[model samples]
Target: MSNTPQKPVIGISCGDLNGIGLELIIKTFSDSRLLELCTPVIFASNKVVNFYRKSITEINFNYQSTKEYNRLNNKQVNVFNCWEEEVAVNPGQLEDAAGKYAVLSLQTAVAALKQQQIDGLVTAPIHKKNIQSPDFNFPGHTPYLKSFFEAKDVVMMMCAGSFRVALVTEHVPVKDIAKYITKENIVSKLHIVHKSLQRDFGIDKPRIAVLGLNPHAGDEGLIGNEEETIIKPAIKEAKNSNMLVVGPFSADAFFARKHYDKFDAVLAMYHDQGLIPFKALASGDGVNYTAGLPVVRTSPDHGVAFDIAGKDKADASSFLTAIYECIDIIQQRADYDLNRSNPLKKINPEVFARMEDEDIRE
Candidate 1:
């Protein structure tokens, strides 16, 4: 929104205090290459960070607390301490205090993003169940951020190098996905995915592939009518919208030899449908990016490994990818603004008019 030419200061949301989030941030901030790309600011406690670094061998970073970001022109990691009540954290353990701290960090980073202090946020993993205390009752970071930014019609995309996959329905049961699939949801997701491919990833015109819910794509409706009854109508709508979207293709046949190269992204019906192939390809380096968020947001595609939290064995590949993606997205988003056409003329009213409740089941 501002015409400032300064490099984006990425706000890092330290996930669980005891989890690998702290370790990942510490490792990333220590890298000289990462520090040069963008200003790194951690919304966490300095004490907790130091405690985790001691358990590891190679930890070289200058962590300092700061309330004013303008005064943080120095080339050191800045910490925004949001810890309300101090509590000792033990690695490899799930404590309520750690959960509370995770949430507090998220809240602070979000506020900084709102104030235009940070260009984007790269979040560390947080235990979902532990963080839903009295103050926070939302789902994982995506939904919670949607509510925070008052944004709708966003999608979750996982990327590792060239592999990019977006989920149509996230954090929902597989059975419920069939019932929720509609022309509106699919079209909305298609538009965001298409725009992101072009606007965020710098693909001028992107080809997108849509996956099916049933095996063999319901065998042309013999195995199940959902392929024709629900998904087809949605694909038709997306195609009419000028989105380069293809298929209700069988997920089995879709990920075959160089299948992903044909399209920029594949829209899956649910989490496992997309993640199964994505994780298989990306492995430990998968990065989960929240597409269509008001501010750029990404996270490592793995969970809080409570078993190996304190063992100093957690791989930080995904963490590095998350930070790199955040920087990439922010830069792309900025460049896109300069080169993009007038988006007001591109917004399709028909896409939004399709009611989400209008589910077809014939």
Candidate 2:
């Protein structure tokens, strides 16, 4: 076998042709420095790529158009045409055509991921409303991937640097948030978060903080019973399992006090409770990672900005960050699995001898 380390093949799914998905993808790959890290395969047609490239005249985006994956160029960006038919390219439009094609790109990219054609996936943002259909009925990519991979559960984690916030309930209404805040669900999410922190992030012992559902963390049951009944019990269960888990802290005070910096990750109760703070604190470099799945998947933290669809004003920082995170996680998982397979390979002979000497002395 060759000893040379191969660059990972990263699959990109053009989220919505009408949105800023193409714009972001083009801009991100325009940086030649990124090409040295991994090979990129974009799941869209050459015509659509040209359409977006024409609009963004400032960027000199170059790509190789290919229908076959085996002939991909590692030194250049590859556009894998999912469909050859001409489609309307209406920027900032909420038509069904754009949504239909968005689903197709996602499905194609996901199929490649399942077949091991790609090492990891970095998805652009997709509008939740227009992308809905009979075949693709999930609220967002996280749930859709969960069903596609048949994973029992997955955590939607927002990461920027060391600040990571995970959601317990995603895309659900505020009124129904309490019903989903059960001990079982909380424990399950905590388990996923803990494992992801260690495996995906390369942290041996991770510290996690859990947020409360209501104000003041239910004020010890004066405001709501969830913190006392549901959250506290869940924290206790996670702790008993010998995990470094803490809190049922008040979301407002915890963030205001900057308590999130102390833990490796935080688990929030609902959507806004986690994402609202994450978007503000992440400084536009946030990445959405789906943890606990068999396959690695990540996306830019923002949605498809229809208002700035064709405009060259959208920043590619978050998109670039997502791609970097996907590559890093792929490598991290490989190292983690290798160490697990041969635990003795990681132990030093000196350390083993020292332990034996100490035992003899005792």
Tens digits of lDDT, candidate 2, 262-311: 99999999999999999999999999999999989999999888898887
Cα-lDDT of candidate 1? 0.84
lDDT scores of the candidates, listed in order: 0.84, 0.91
* Clashing pairs counted in every model: 0, 0
Segments in model 1 whose C-alpha atoms lie over 4 Å from true places: 1-6, 341-362
lDDT of model 2, residue 117: 87
Per-residue lDDT for 112-148 in model 1, tens only?
A: 8988888889999999888997779977999889889
**Best-matching candidate per lDDT:** 2
